[model samples]
Target chain A: MDVSEQIHAELKKCGVRLAASLPDDWVAPLIRRLDADNDIRHVPVGRESEAVMVASGAFFGGVRSVAVIGNTGLLTCTGELATLNLRHQIPVFCIVSMRGSIDDHQIYQEVQGRRTIPVLQAYDFPYRVIDRPEEIGCIPDAYQWCRLQKRPFILFLTRALLKGRRWS
Target chain B: MIAKEAIRVLAAHRGDAIAVCALGVAANEWWDATKAEDCFQMHGAMGFAASFALGLALSLPNVNIWIINSDGSLCMNPGCLLTEAAQAPRNLKHFVIDNQVYQTVGAVPMVNAGRTDYAGLARAAGIASTHTIDNVPEMEKQLPRLIAGPGPTFVVLRVEPDPSHINTPPVTYEGPEMKYRFGRALEKRFGISVFNSSGY
Candidate 1:
């Protein structure tokens, strides 16, 4: 099976009934897989913040959901994550692309690589970087931990994890 | 029409439907009118109430979901209409309370103020059923049908901006309390657990 398929199976184990996504290249395959699944209701949002909000709402509805977006998109939605998830203590798990990493040669993504973790730390949002296929099995535990934490938790997919090789 | 009165009228007709209210006037008014635990009032993320409601609607499928949005909030994230339209949850109804100004911040004029056509925007976003109601009577008259109709339907409620409303304040409970109340309320209503045994 493909890496996206493996991740999809893990998400299924999480019992994620809904997924709201705004795609970034690294996570696009996973988003497409989620969209194709009949069991997981896929919502394609215009903005990354909408995915965060949608996932938060799903939490209240007793639905497990994940937001699939890029690192840049994650940066754009910190304010929403803070005020909505942090203030209200709402748990939302997000699967974000780990862009701007050493292996990611895209110039536009460098800033995101440099800034994403610090920003998450500054906001006290927990995150886990999964750089290998073996790490994908931890998704269900991460999902449960996100619910336990009662705030936004980021599960980052590195280029190596997605493509099975370094871009560099 | 008075915004409060309009909200009151809308409140009277809301049966078992869940509400996701945007920040400022509409959310405050919703709390003032209903004191509903099942309703989730936003404190931040000004524009994403519609998105949140759409998620809820998709998840519940059997329950009606209403978003009490605002003109300012709508402008903050107009693209929500596109997302909502694409999903087209039949259980979702979107209501934009257009007061023509930022009423919570002492009634500052809205950008493009009276010229922006919100309902038209929703229609262009692929929502076939849309209405702009300028009075309480029209709101009362149209709500039943709109609620009954398939969504994502959009309705714009136009009202004069009242600076006095700024002083009215939001609901008494703060953020975390609001979460527990809302989550617990939903759990009781739907017989589904929103939290774990340890209550995270």
Candidate 2:
């Protein structure tokens, strides 16, 4: 199976009954996989913040869920994440595209590549980066850890995990 | 119509529907009316309560979900209308309190306040069930039908603003306390487990 399929399996194992997403290129494939699953209710939001708030609400409704977005979109969601999730102690797991990395030639993602981790650190939001196929198995544990932490946790998918080679 | 009175009417007709309120006047007033622990009143994330309610509705398809939104909050994330329309969760009902001012912030007038037609916006976003009520009597007459109708429905309540309630406190619980109370209330009401066995 491919990376998207593997991650989808892990999410199912994590008891995720819903997913809210605004797609970025790297995470779009996984979002498609999630949408195709009939058991998981898919919410396609207009802004990244909506995904966070939606997933937070699902938690209160006894449904496990995830938010999928891009790096810049993740930055756009920090305020809502801090206020809603941090304040209420709701946990939302997010799958993000690891943009602006060495293999990512997109100049627009440069700022996010340099600053995203620090920004997450500033807020004490935990994160994990998966660069290889084998590491995808850890998602279920990370999802459980997110629930225990009572806050937003991110799993970033690197270019190597998807494309297997650098873009020219 | 006024916010408090309108909210009181809404609460009287709440039935078994669970509420998720936006922060500020809408939430404060709903707390005043219902004193419901099951209602999740947002302390922050001002505008996205609609999205929250939508999510909850989708997750709990058997339950009715109501969102008490405000005009200012509606403007902050109008895109939620599109998303709500797209999902079309029939169990969800959305109400926008059109008070023409930011009531909590000392009566500051909202931008294009009286002119912005929120019901129209929702209709444009593809919500076929939309209504605007400008008086308490009209709300009393139309509200029950609207609530019982197939959703996602959008109702715009035109009410007069009162800055005096600016100092009115939010609901008794907040932060994580509000979270636990609201979640526990749901677990009790629906017999669903919102928290893990460890009481997280």
Q: Which stretches of candidate 1 lie over 4 Å from their true place?
A: none
Query: In candidate 1, what are the lDDT values of residues B1-200, reduced to their tens digit?
Result: 86887788889988988998999988888899999988989888888888788888888888888899999999999999999889888888888899999887778899999999999999999999999998877777888888888877898988888776776679888999999998899999889888889888
- lDDT (Cα, tens digit) per residue for candidate 2, span B22-52: 9988888899888898899998887899988
- TM-score, B chain alone, candidates in order: 0.97, 0.97
The deviation in Å at residue A74 for candidate 2 is: 0.4
lDDT of 2 at B181: 94
TM-score of candidate 2 to 2 decimals: 0.98
For candidate 1, the chain B TM-score comes to 0.97
Ten contiguous residues minimizing lDDT sum, candidate 2 chain A? A159-168
TM-score of each: 0.98, 0.98
Candidate 2 at residue A126, lDDT? 93
